[model samples]
Target: MASASPLIDRHGRTISYLRISVTDRCDLRCRYCMAEQMTFLPRERLLSLEEIALIAERFIARGTSKIRLSGGEPLVRRDIIDLARRLGRHLGDGGLDELTMTTNGVRLGEHAEALADAGMRRVNVSLDSRDPEVFRHITRHGQIETVLGGIAAAKAAGLAVKINMVALKGLNAHEIADMLAWCADEALDLTLIETMPMGSVDEDRADRFLPLTHILDDLLGRFDLRRDAHRSGGPARYWRLAGTDTRLGLISPLTANFCDGCNRVRLTTEGRLYLCLGHDDQVDLKAAIRDGGLPAVDAAIDAALAIKPRRHDFRIAEGSAPAVARHMSVTGG
Candidate 1:
């Protein structure tokens, strides 16, 4: 394996962002995310908090500057704030530049202050609909009020919050504009995402796959949107919404491929590093660590980067299997 500071894949993209899924367990079962009766990994199979921090340290040492902690609902993990604090220590003076999270907002109300105290300045919360009935239907059994309260708490704790909404054709498509306006009113950033074919869920993804192009066309007539160069170290194309401080982002994985500049990799809870979201290319860092500690893990990472694919094979069709067998929760959102 090659010894390098910043990991560069064979495709020549610099890898600087690392997303770690601390656990696969979630408090809610969103229809687009997973099955209602999903089987979660056993606790013993997950990387201990200490091990996650150690491996994350290796990535930081290799020039990973941004780290985002995610899960089915990251706040659901016990002592997750501890992990944030451990990794937060890496910030400042030529170390990790940013430490953030992607959560469902179910438990954010309870942990927001701790997370802010742990050095997190921002977070991305997944919320599909503001309508109570629609929200419960999409999430199967989630209370929108709980999520809203969590968002309130996060903001109160001085964390900049961004709302992530998965666009669904018949379900929430009519509410996208309303959601954007609500985001603007709340002084929050809003990102519209096209549903990806990741896991086997109850509904047909093709029916819910609302191309962002159609949504953008509708918004163009209503809002004064201009292309913005703001990048949040993710795959979203940003636009500055005129008349408000809200920045709108669109993540269209199917219609507009964003893999050419992919700069991130995912680390599963089980210690597997997935090169691409829609591919199975992986390296077992947990085994590497248990077998030979940090040096072995470093070599394994280099080997994985050498084989990272230039793009992912993502497609959506009726009666089709997922792009990969694994769910989005397994790889983190």
Candidate 2:
């Protein structure tokens, strides 16, 4: 009721998608995600299900129609399924239109059925490499078969699934063709994302940065990449694979910035509402919730929307360094 004007930022962009990071803890030690030894938010500091739901309610009420649960690995959280079940209630009728999640898929095999049963619409699993050694090198002991099994389990549970592959030059870049063939054979939606220069994740990015430009060139040179319209507020550009039903997508925040169409914001596990993934600007939602509940939350959301940056500055920061120096895991990337 308080937010009658809708959640539009200064640039007139309607904020309809929200990515909520339930926990900062993760099982893998991805080379490009976070350092092997990382400090995560304490349990008491993380928002409870009630707090998460209330905050989500405020956003949904203000024209936020999409919600995606994210984390260092959401399945690592004990009550994540319960959280998903609770959050899924805010869909359809007068609530959110969709609720999905992004995960590493390490534990997906065990939780896929429960997650889908809990009302999850779909899921995106980040699997960088299909080779066991490369997967282990990128994720520090991540088993390719295990993740493949998880992906299989998710599909078996009747949930639509997508695979996210971060294209790292020299490391996993050579595997792009292999990944595409595998995804095509499996009929899985596959998206190749250029690595973001997020803090420590970018330490070797100069060497590892694999632009989607080359990948796109390869795909276009071989097959017809028919552009597809996207309804989700995500940044990935969708494409239909020629004569097949398999889909292809590219998320090139570095090479081709999609800031002008940024329809989403993120809530960190500790409750900071980040306007842009490449900036440190945030509104402290945990403080607002603790201080004044929904009234304060509404005010915080309003304040956040008022100053939300129209586009991120990941391309042109200052030096060769990334614009934002925060870790992706903690930032809820």
Candidate 3:
């Protein structure tokens, strides 16, 4: 069999992962992602399932082997199941080594089985605080029980589940130990993420941003933790609780910039491709698709890939205003 051509960027890094936002519509107004009340994109502005799949096909043909479906809230999209089935068909049975989705878990209970059957191999569910009231306070929506039930349903559906917890100082930072303990018992992968400066969360409030290093220090005194064998894909760095097989992951996006090996690219629901999360540089593939031919579309993609920044400068520098000011919900988190 002929080897698939490598999709290397200007820096010579192989790009194999693609994150496609199915819709920029999400149910929860998480304090970190959006304001208490904000306008969402009109229905007509979002990309259709067919358009998303067509882009995926083009990327797959260019050696992308992994694809993850994300959304402001993916499950909220009426025909999400159909979208998943279509993406699965394009990826084929094992054509793409990995296919997954990241969700807030609001609608997973009803959609888990269908998603798994449609060839989604694993899922990453966001659960920042296990405390119901705290969860509500952070997300502005008190749906903790529903999210937990969704996690249970996803696990029961035989999907590899990873719990994503965004630790905020004075908020859910104290729950890290407890979160890890629960994940250990449930046999789930726990990822602790530091807050980013992009959302409605004020820059001053971002000072309360909890770094993963502090969490590690706190855990070291409580449990024996050891760095685990490194994995190729995904952003988090994995480590195991010393005595058990249960593993924990850390995403210190604020402090640690993993841009040198950024094997992934993000496509907004509306057809814009962003090279980095912290910067506003994006390519408008949707307009190209409508106005230009396939060559034009591919050229836009290549241009985006060529200009992919060496790394996101979030430390010494401030965040840039996005070329498209659509919030995380519209851009697909």
Candidate 4:
């Protein structure tokens, strides 16, 4: 922990983890994620793969150690494996300590082995429900079997697999126990994330927003769940299932905020730098890089770090929340 690094924000949070979104395109349109007939980003607007690696290398040089590739679905990006191979060069030999991705798992089954061979360490697959019909309904038309098969493929490829479920109140609350049980049976770590007030989902948000605290309360009442004292670099705080290796993780962005300990930043496919996930504040790094190269990147990073909000000032208070007008897909989940 060097005190002189520019990645340290005003709040004393060191930005070590950088999430790079490869594309804003997705196969399935989830209700909470995007609206029907949502417009996609133009292909040319995205930063080139070479630019992605160059920007990441600059971050690594400045003490950023972990990089996670993300997207509306990363696999949909053309030549993503090539990008993985290029970014992998920034890891582990006094470089990035880990390289990972958060995918919808739509295309993971076919590309898992190649991704591993290209140096991805692990993957977090988004699977909201295990029920086929419910899964299709939630994702607008996604195949549960496809995601399941992809998870299996990732596991077989020797990549550490973790399943992420966006826990909603009236929607999937009843299936919480089923999700936990299934993860245990599959020997996969399960992380239950509370719905955040991002994008235009505010109209039905309050009614649908389920806090992770409530889910934990139910699990604690029904089973012997205890917190694991081990350190996990990510936001989720884990609780191990008694007598088994399967653990439950809770990410409460609304009811409980983790910003005080935040250690990451996000880079959108078009190169907008989001210092916090819930805010609209962004630094146009694409312009910086296009204009002045690495020196511009260094200056932009320092400027963004200086004004990084101490905590996300999300607009939500039961009645109305301003339309974020952006979805997690474009924001890289």
lDDT tens digits by residue: candidate 3, 1-333: 123345788898888898888877678878877777676668787777877777777788778888888878888888889978877875564457777899999999999999989988789999999899999998897589999999999989998898988888888988999999998888888888887666554334444578788899899888778999867387888899866657898888777777787898889888899887777788998887778855667888889888888787654233444223446665555
Candidate 2 residue lDDT tens string, 137-197: 8898788888888999999999888889999878887788778778878878889998777
Error (Å) of candidate 4 at residue 85 is 1.0
Collision count for each candidate, in order: 0, 0, 1, 0
Task: Output the worst ten-in-a-row residue range by lDDT, candidate 3.
Answer: 316-325
Off by over 4 Å in 3: 1-5, 90-94, 316-326
Model 4: CA > 4 A from native = 1-6, 201-203, 315-319
Worst 10 residues of 1 by lDDT: 1-10
Evaluate residue 302 in candidate 4 and report its C-alpha lDDT on the 0 to 100 scale.
92
lDDT per residue for candidate 1 within 1-333, as digits (tens), equals 222567899999999999999999999999999999999999989999999998998889888999999987888889899999989988895789999999999999999999999999999999999999999999999999999999999999999999999999889999999998999999999999988899899888998888999999999888999999999999999998998889999998899999999999999999999999999999999999999998899899999999898998789988888898899999999
TM-score of 3: 0.92
RMSD of each: 1.6, 1.9, 2.7, 2.3
Residue pairs whose backbone atoms clash in candidate 1: none
Question: Of models 3 and 4, which has the larger lDDT?
Answer: 4
User: Which residue runs of candidate 2 sit more than 4 Å off their true CA positions?
Assistant: 1-4, 315-319
Weakest ten-residue segment in model 4 by summed lDDT: 1-10
Give the TM-score comparing model 2 with the true structure, all chains together: 0.95
Error of 1 at 37 (Å): 0.3
Top of the candidates by lDDT: 1
| Tens-digit per-residue lDDT, 186-215, candidate 4 | 888889987776776424677777877878
Point out the higher-scoring one by TM-score: 1 or 3.
1
TM for every model, in the order presented, reads 0.98, 0.95, 0.92, 0.95
